[model samples]
Target: MATRPTMPAAAATTSPDDLLRLDRQVCFALAVAARNVIALYRPVLEPLGLTHPQYLVMLALWERSPLTVREIGQLISLEPATLSPLLKRLESAGLVTRDRHPEDDRALAITLTERGRLLREQALQVPPRIVATLGMDVEELQALHASLSRVIAASTPAHQPRR
Candidate 1:
């Protein structure tokens, strides 16, 4: 049988108070960092006429268009309720078109417009700008991304058969 690794003795010896410290809390750090990083994207995305969430949606569509609302939500880890309004706004901006799927009347297909496709040219500059603003090299950001992926996987629930 395989065994799980344990924390080192020194780390295991942390007191309850040490564990309770706000600065040491992963959730606290993640929340603050998320807000700050999103704030950094605000100015960059503003000229592109997209908020951070909208930009994320565009990024997904740029990769694969004509995805259903549910598929886009799954790709972005956003709820359908939240994504619906964002899609509407993008449609309003003429960046995308949302139409009922011919095969599945209930499903809405999201496709980027010609303007949206052209916007990708401008959007290409965003990453390099953000990287410059963050002062982090591509390698460092890649490593951070890998670490965050591990953290996300560890935090999500594992599906198991019901008893």
Candidate 2:
């Protein structure tokens, strides 16, 4: 059986200064982990012609097509300013279409094109490839996901003014 790698021990004596240490910062660790994991997706997504953010937008659209820009932003936790350029690029790639909503002149509705729909089949391979690259078991990944979800929930402010 393979042994799991262990983290280095923390200082035996806890000092107030320990709280300020770089290694002890959760935000730093989370940011590093996010960057590293996203880096792992870069090569895999390249063949599909997507950047990490574009891949996320595609994932949202795959789950539910014809979503409004606002809806996609809400689902992906991105601002419209950030998502608009992505949608425009996807539209240019012939993967998606942006149309003015029938009922709301101000709203833009995003829909997957035929190419986008077909890309889903290729995307089906991405998760398994990522799992293999991570070298983690499904159960372990699930537990980590649960813990991260808890952290996100705890860190999010209780009151958010609706946009």
Candidate 3:
């Protein structure tokens, strides 16, 4: 076998036109797919009086109750400013409660009410139900999830930027 010389690393630039191709842009496809997936959840979530972001907050709370507002924001990737209003809405709807943390006066902890805990039973079906509705079996869904998880893991930065 014969070996060929490697080109200089800096000589690998592609034309702007080529770079702009949709097939080459992973971010574009990911954005479109996320939008479409969220759209599918609209009807499912509407009857429960929850927006997608709210549903995400509920998910975190349901997994483990009594997380501080800042903890919830970190888990859901939302800012405190944005999460405050959502928490208020959930509070208004009688789903969650925001109270002062026992140990820290400045920190507010969020807890699920009885109603919120009950909501978790209903939401539990959401994952498998949504998967079944997509016409994919366990194996296919697992494969897709694994692939997307890899992509997300790679895309997320080690140190998130401060807001």
Candidate 4:
């Protein structure tokens, strides 16, 4: 671990400008933005019977079904403990199957059910709705996604979490 650099007592006690305000903090902005964006998706996702996190899971499964729980967690940045209940709820809704992998009985495989496969048609509407709701040009949103991707990569730890 690195140690904090020591500063003179007078320097440590004062700010040159009033820049330590909450509205100026990047973390505060990120937190509020994350909440508001997720809130926007709430109403949009209601008809599909999905919460924000569930939607993320569905997106992973939509791209490729029969993924292992660990793979889904890695893709979605969720821990298994957090993801388990979501999988259970999806299973109960008959949208997905949590069964043993055909090749390896010990590993759980998450495959979309027939109903879930059909839901993809409805899911196709989601992106456009979100874009309209944000009232941003697709180019701008794409730029922001690229920026956020960079932020995530820069802020993430050097070591990946254990699978």
TM-scores of all candidate predictions against the true structure:
0.92, 0.88, 0.82, 0.85
The C-alpha lDDT values of all candidates are 0.93, 0.94, 0.87, 0.91
Model 1 TM-score is: 0.92
Task: Provide the clash count, candidate 4.
Answer: 0
Instruction: lDDT for model 1, please.
Output: 0.93
Per-structure clash totals for the candidates? 0, 0, 0, 0
Candidate 4's displacement at residue 24, Å, is 1.6
In angstroms, the error of model 3 at 21 is 0.9
Number of the candidate with higher TM-score, 3 or 4 = 4
lDDT of each residue in 1-163, candidate 4, tens digit only: 9998898675567685645778667789989999999999999899999999999999999999989888999999999889989999999999999999898887789999999989889989999999999999999999999998988887788644555
User: What is the alpha-carbon lDDT for the whole of candidate 2?
Assistant: 0.94
Order the numbered candidates by TM-score, best leading: 1, 2, 4, 3
Candidate 1: residue 160 Cα off by (Å): 8.7
Which parts of model 4 have CA positions greater than 4 angstroms off? 1-17, 159-163
| lDDT-superior candidate, 1 or 2 | 2
lDDT of 1 by residue, 21-112 (tens): 89988899999989998999999999999999999999999999989999999888899999999999999999999999878999999999
List ranges where model 1 is wrong by over 4 Å.
1-5, 158-163
- Location of the lowest summed lDDT over 10 successive residues in candidate 4: 10-19
